[model samples]
Target: MRPYPSRSYQAIFWLVFGGALAYCVYGLIVGDLYFVGKSGRGAHLHGVPAWCFTAFVTFLGAGVWMREFSTISSRYRTRFEILFLVSGFSLLVLGWNYSP
Candidate 1:
């Protein structure tokens, strides 16, 4: 397996990861997990749902871990990477036109 990236890179990754996780948690707690938008018809709309946002972040986070960690077996890494990509992409598409 290849070596991990520099310390600074890891630090930055963790920082962003932590921040995203914290934000997700805060949103869930506050019930403000969705974005509010005004429709052309003067109707109020909601963006992505809370569950989709949380799942996307979760899958992406796991994918990052699988890519970075040298300790995990390669056999499972590829499978998980594919799963993550598919899940994240599906979530993105599912939320692309959310307006309910």
Candidate 2:
């Protein structure tokens, strides 16, 4: 496979992908937020804020856009990039406001 013309694009792709994955793992390990334990009865886990869920979805979408940004055809590349930017910032803002 040919390399993307821009090294920076590749870097961005990996960064977003890795960041999203790490975030997921972190959430899981924390166990009180998004991750749930199967311990029987009275699992009084604090309800996660809606913004946290929104942020997670947006972050994943941004990662997808980053991964496909250079692979898609030119016609759709711009659209995807726009989606990526919008989602990325949406994720950021939602995350910033997120609280258990």
Candidate 3:
């Protein structure tokens, strides 16, 4: 049996996406970032929570990388996108969840 190119690429895309999603979710649940709060107010000025921003950026950055992948040859496209997304999301999740 032979595999379709598009299907194979899509499958790999999803595998990478799933890994990124799981990494973020784990950071969220285990890191207790939920309790840390997404946004809040104080006596002075209301401030946006950094974690929420990080999460947003990580998830959105994936889209940017995906777009770039379209211009590259197939040989490196999947590999680049996979590693980029996985590492980017993982770092974002960990950094967002961690606080000094």
The per-model lDDT (C-alpha) reads 0.72, 0.57, 0.53
- Give model 3 RMSD, 1 decimal: 10.4
Highest TM-score against the true fold, candidate: 1
Instruction: Give the higher-TM-score candidate: 1 or 2.
Output: 1
Score residue 1 of candidate 1 by CA lDDT. 65
RMSD of 2: 8.9
Off by over 4 Å in 2: 1-16, 32-69
Model 3 lDDT tens row, 1-100: 2333476666777677666556555555555323233578322111233344345556555654454435566667667667666665775566556555
Pairs that collide in candidate 2 are: none
Q: Is candidate 1 or candidate 2 better by lDDT?
A: 1
**Candidate 1 per-residue C-alpha lDDT over 5-49 given as tens digits, one digit per residue, 9 for 90 to 100:** 888988888889888878777787776664445754332223356
Query: Ten residues in a row with the worst lDDT in model 2?
Result: 42-51
Could you say which candidate leads in lDDT? 1
Clashes of 1: 0
- Candidate 2 lDDT at 7 equals 71
- In every candidate, how many clashes are there? 0, 0, 0
Tens digit of per-residue lDDT, candidate 2, span 1-100: 4455577876876787676566655554665534445775532222344345535555556646555645666657667767766776766566556564
